[model samples]
Target: MLQSTEHCHIVRNSEILSGEPIIRGTRTPVRAIVEMWRIGVSPEEIPQRLPHLVLSQVFDALSYYLDHQVEINEYIEHNRIPDELIDPRVRKA
Candidate 1:
């Protein structure tokens, strides 16, 4: 994994998610944390949702996103699922 100089808990590894910044030791992308926060999951509670993460890792992921909004947002936007793209089995009736 490629360690990031910008944040202690963040790293980029080409083998992982096309090198998107992720929590240092996990495949969880920084954007995943950011999106959870954006949707109103408090940082303290984030660890409850993703048990592998601790509060510090959540904060650092948020910090990394703030420091690199455009980069991370692009990842978010690019990965967003349009309504039409949702699988029929999962779409609400």
Candidate 2:
């Protein structure tokens, strides 16, 4: 699982995203992973899309989500853009 101290493999610190918890070194947030799983994406497919991540990390992140459901879910909800501002076609829009 991703310890709070362990930097995400995809999340980045951009002044724009309010420094939200992201996938690692990018603006992609951990929420994306949660959304993908919600949509039936297999754990194996994640690595193909995110070559930088190992399957273990992906699983670990999910485990982290399960263990910290309330905190992580709140983070996702807080970071979510409003429907009035986002395109519905976007993954988690």
Candidate 3:
């Protein structure tokens, strides 16, 4: 079931990524947006990469992240692929 957050564009559903907060009506997680921005992707270009999202959704996801840093950061860390799980050839230096 979908659950609404304080933000209008953000929501969570237990069936989706175990209830990770996501942009409403899409499976794209707010973390995905944050991660992209963290890696230097500009807001204007986010939708180009995540075509499913618009500028408003991208900005809202970022706003939600700011409001719930601890929660979202936990998800980020938990979802990260550990070095041991990385394939030898695919692992980053």
Candidate 4:
């Protein structure tokens, strides 16, 4: 594991996921957890959906999100596909 703050399970390394904050010891981005929660995935259900993570890791990801919403939200928006590029058939109403 990379050197991390004593109080949190989140870490960022330039070599990992392009330095996005992630759950320590894993490549799971904090944004992924935020997105899941935003879409209505409960904390208890997160681990079931992502078998590699535990409830604690999910919580840590969330805590990271709360501490850095702007950065993560920007990353999310930056990664979003433009509407024009979406196929009409797959676009949600």
Which is better, 1 or 4, measured by TM-score?
1
Worst 10 residues of 2 by lDDT: 1-10
lDDT of 1 at 4: 76
Question: Over the stretch 12-78, how does candidate 2's per-residue lDDT look in tens digits?
Answer: 3646366555555445566677767878988899878887777776776777677667877888788
Per-candidate TM equals 0.89, 0.63, 0.91, 0.87
lDDT of each: 0.93, 0.66, 0.94, 0.86
Pairs of residues clashing in candidate 3: none
- Angstrom error of the Cα, residue 7, model 4: value is 5.0
Which residue runs of candidate 4 sit more than 4 Å off their true CA positions? 1-7
* Cα lDDT tens digits for candidate 4, 1-93: 254644378888778878888788888888899999999999899999999999999988888788788999998998889999999999999
Which regions of candidate 2 fall more than 4 Å away from where they truly are?
1-29, 88-93
- Encode model 1's per-residue lDDT on 1-93: one tens digit a residue: 485757899999989999999898899999999999999999999999999999999999999899999999999999999989899999889
Best model number under lDDT: 3
Decide which is better by lDDT, 1 or 3: 3
How much lDDT does candidate 3 score? 0.94
User: What lDDT is reached at residue 34 by model 2?
Assistant: 78
Clashes of each: 0, 10, 0, 0
The full ranking of all candidates by TM-score, starting with the best, is 3, 1, 4, 2
Number of the predicted model whose TM-score against the real structure is largest: 3
Cα RMSD to the true fold for all candidates: 1.9, 5.2, 1.2, 1.9
